[model samples]
Target: MFSSVVAVCIACFLAYIFNQRSREQAGDKNGKPIPGPPSLPILGNLCDIPKSHSWFRFKEWTDHYGPIVRFKIGASEHVIIAEEKIANDLLRERGSHYSSRVFLPMAAEYLSGNMRPLFMPYNDLWRTSRKLMHRLTMPSMANSYQPAQSIESARLLHDLLQDPRNYERWLQRYSGGLIFRIVYGKRVQTGEENYLQRAIKVVHNVERIASPGSYLVDVLPFLRYVPYPLAPFKQEGMRLHSEELDLFRSLLDDARKELETPDVLKRPSFAQTFLEEQEAIGLTFDQGAYVLGSLFEAGTGTTAAAMMSFLLTMTLHPQWQEFLWAELDAVVGDRMPDFEDIPRLPRVRAVIKEVLRWRPVTAGGAPHTLTKDDEYNGFKFAAGTTFHPVQWAIHLDPVLYPDPDQFDPSRWLDPSFPTYKRPLDKFPTLQNFSAFGFGRRICPGMNIAERSLYILTARIAWACKISKAKDSQGVIIDVPSYDYTSGFNVMPKNFAFNLSPRSKLHEQVVEERYRYANNLIYLKPKL
Candidate 1:
């Protein structure tokens, strides 16, 4: 009878708490400012979220609630800002208060202990990570990687020339090479020799697990306590996480060995740069280690997918293909395209922008968690809600780009083409797009990715004609319908294309470069 009374007392306390929260939400004059979506009793709009693609569903809600919409999930409230104008205000203008990541129950509570800097809240540590990235990879400072980009792009061209069936692999190799080389001062060999590939493959598993609603462990944190025998999936995931740590640890050791050599530090890649800079900044060794790892996560995956998109877009649009070749032939000619040639290739840059816009690397960016209560438009966001602004929706906004679904870079050529560029600025580049990210979360490796993408795409288009293959049935294959792999980082679904030298001279040019590039650097993978 005493225990029963205690249970009733507990129920009464929960009821009292819910009543107070409801009263706060209902708005007496003393209540918090802003509008909110219609909420369910306790669970709120939690039931509506996973019913469809959350990003697409959010697009519909954004239409109803303007740029910033207030919605609830479980007991949490969030503000979704779909409008770029508003995003600019909050993400850029109000960065200090607005930059914090929302507290994800599973991400914060169970999966990682929120060790990842991307999920880390805005604090001294987050500031340290941000400062380290700025110190090492600031826009002016990141040019140290240009030489690496050029060498890797040449190797990428040779790889495509040898075996185009796996163009996707080449793109991944280029991205991995850039980041590993940048941070660790270690070169990732092309073809099979890439040690970084092992690291990449492992890191991708973490990405796959963290994608939207991919695991129930992220939702029901209690499930983590389940025994291994009953929960095989958790066991497998735990095994994968262990393997990832081993992989990262191995790279950290590898970087230390290369550091001893001293001669290998050409551009002072991100790791090398940080080791030197962090001492002045008062960052700890653990901070440096995780900073490098976070750079790896931010570096290779999404940018590689974007490169794959460029190749896919080229395969899909023959007109654009023809146009890029014309520019390549006209500007750079028989010689290879370099950094100087990028500015002259306006349409190529526009195409890159449009492709990223169409199928963004992150369908929505890595979720941003709110730090404190704030009003967005008329909506109120609580301190601990995840905000995932859909890049597809933002890129395809009709008001921003008319007839947005189509892939017409020519629209970008419309001198009045309103991009994120400073108003009236003509030249379009990756810098104009938030494809990297917003505010504090902007990709630190963008400089390396941009230079790599520019050099490699220009070379591929210049040296070869990109066209789809024919199956045994003799029907012309389309690139998009071919195959696509999806997770957080999406890419062409393993599509095949034919690669032949534009001329015998082009072939010789590729071969000659390949021979000299033998000294460039490579590491063959073990199976």
Candidate 2:
């Protein structure tokens, strides 16, 4: 209750300050600034931006005002690209100029010590960090991690068979475990395990703090100067910062110690890899630790959320499940699906693409900043302007995707749509404006994320029957199209669904694969 009051007070205070500031003429008559909602004195549409699910509202604005729309909130200038072509032109074609990140005071500065790679501005440090991460997540190197991904996914299938009710938790664990194990060489068997808990807490702290419009300190940098006694957010930031330092630093130390043990070969961990090239890469201890944390956070939450969306789509649209199952049974038979089977399972790939488009994990996108003044379609865009590649709008564009709201995997299967083709062996192409972001700032973990989704969803389709849950009255529960939790990455709210083994033979195959998968997890450590 007190936090709510504080947040309201902060918003009111910020609004008052915004009211006092004079609005600037953003562009000349010949090439006026992009059209947006009319601004009030200093507030400049600050209050117009919704506190939750702003992506939907931004999409609405684009629908009304056209592809490119501009808005000002306090001192910040924003240009939202709703169309893919414009997003591609600016965010992809002109990525060199738009790759830098906007200043994040509360999220990136105090909480993260300005070290979180996702929030870092484009610079030598960011470049070096990016290179280090590329060594692990690059397509050529990503194949090495497939064995772990496969085993972890198989374990997820086994868990689902045992306890389908907690399917959400199992998916979360799978995503968290795979990334955590890959990064720290520590497994997350359960949600409450020490490694998973610490990693999740660190990520939650940053997400809560970093969300746009969450902290007044982010809007008005001077508030950070307030004394610790009065500034509760600062105090919280300090506590989280201390916790992060202790947790990540200790993990780094442990990895170092483990590598030095007698007869112990170095583990396949980002920490060990980073340590090996630490001097060559010119990164400090803190940089390496934060990189791991960033990878785990990005890889886990988004992947888990997308998987959740997939389950929800299946439950809501069970008619398609039969089609998917038919495809799975014909192509994969009774065995668990693997990366090698991706080519044969075009329907599964189409379903994954549709799910990503229907509910993008990064709906509002990680905000990118303009480094210099630029013009787009006769509109003047000043430097330092924040551009949001609003996925909700882009994916729903009528021209690009007909009947965008409908969960139709057939769109990808159709020959007319060239961009909808299933990724052949390699992961989903990040070249276009499909999810995983765009341009230089596209997800480095795209290879792993796509592969994880494919392997898990394909296995689920092969092994289980997904259908809408029914009540005592034998009536299917109605699921609203957009019933979802609100956040930077929007996801489906908890919903009831029936998931059971497709057949005894399928279950047996799943069991055998689960047992076989153990070899990947146990054997890798020995070597």
Candidate 3:
């Protein structure tokens, strides 16, 4: 009887909070509603929003409502900036008010304990974390990481040669292994470890709960008031929180142990670096652990996803793959491509650029939270409005990219293209425009990601020929359409492909390179 009474009280409190927020959302300070689909009285388009592949729906909204579109889900207002210029003006020029992350109760508070820098609100904690990340990834320091990245790329090639059937697994292992070394000061030899599987699980769980409308507690903040027994979501959040803490803390302890040996300190890992200067940073041990672990979390999945998409694209568009191969043969020869070769092979660089634009790993960039009331043109935005810079819409803009759906590396090569720039090294200039992001909140890992992708993709093309698999009848199977896995970080769906060494000579070259790289172990610094 007591429990029933408490439930009733909680329900009433939630309804009241919802009603108040609804009242606030019903009004527009400019006296005109922002352009959006028709919303119902109380629900405010709650039923209209899809839980997955929301970027596609957002692009459709842009088609009808112009570049800047606004919609309400429940009592919250969401603004999606499709125009590149507007995104620059708001998210870049006025970054002070727009750089904060949207409040995600389940993700930031319950699950991550607000340790993940990307999900953190703009505050002292975020500032400290960002500073550490920036120092790690800044351009001047990016080159130091190449040795580690090169070694891992060699290992990846060796893995692929031995087990081409599990190409996807090898790719994930490569990405995770690179980060494990960078952050934790350890190399993932086999990649078939419990840690890798659990890490993937943690990311998926965060995506499921953090995404808008996935959990009622995030949408209806008052739901947090319910008793633990009544709220399964909260229980699940607590469970995830504990699991993540244990995993990250264990990695941190391992790094700490490495620091005790002077030899390990010479090639300082991210965790070791932070620990050596923990006093100056003013972050607790656990905070440092989570910060480094969060970096690993952000880097691994997206890079792997992009590579998978690259393979899928290769299988579907053999002409492009052949073109890349022709360039590789002419420029790189039998040698694996490295950082020095980036400038010499513009076509190879263009292919990587087009791949990122065509199938962005995170289609909708992280939601930008507004800290204060703002006005754009004549439209007035409330203080708490959450903005989503929809990469799908922006990358597919017909005016910027003609026939945007088609994969054409030639567009980047053409001097006439609006977004075209010379010297692929300066491609996607951090500030003005990029697949990485916009403004103060742009991904600090951009430099690292670009470098790593170039090395891995170029070397893969140089060493192998990616094509569609064959059936028993010696007929080529049709490549699957661009169907992707569902979540915030979209990857190509499982597809059949034939990844083969380009030649017996190339296979021998990979083995020799791997043997040489394996013998020279370096402490791969985190960026």
Q: Candidate 3's residue-wise lDDT over 1-527, tens digit each? A: 68746775675566556656755754577555678887764456667878878887889999999998888765677888887788889998999999887777788888988788878998999999889888887776667888888888999988887877787788888888877777777778788788877777777777667666787666666667778887787788889999989998988887788778665444457887888899998889888878887777777888888888888888888889788888888987877788898777777777877888899887876789899888888888887788999888988988999899999988887777887877765553323345778898887777777778888888888898888999999998887667886666788877888888889999999999899988987854444
lDDT per model, in order?
A: 0.67, 0.79, 0.80
lDDT tens digits, residues 89-115, model 2?
Answer: 898899999999988777777788889
Per residue, candidate 1 scores C-alpha lDDT tens digits across 58-129 of 777776766666666534446676766766776767677667875543444333435567667888978877
Best-fitting candidate, scored by TM-score: 3
Instruction: Please report the TM-score between candidate 3 and the true structure.
Output: 0.94
All predictions: root-mean-square deviation over Cα? 5.4, 3.5, 2.5
- Show the colliding residue pairs in model 3: none
For candidate 2, the per-residue lDDT at 358 reads 89
Candidate 3 off by > 4 Å: 1-26, 261-267, 423-433, 523-527
lDDT ranking from best candidate downward: 3, 2, 1
Ranking by TM-score: 3, 2, 1
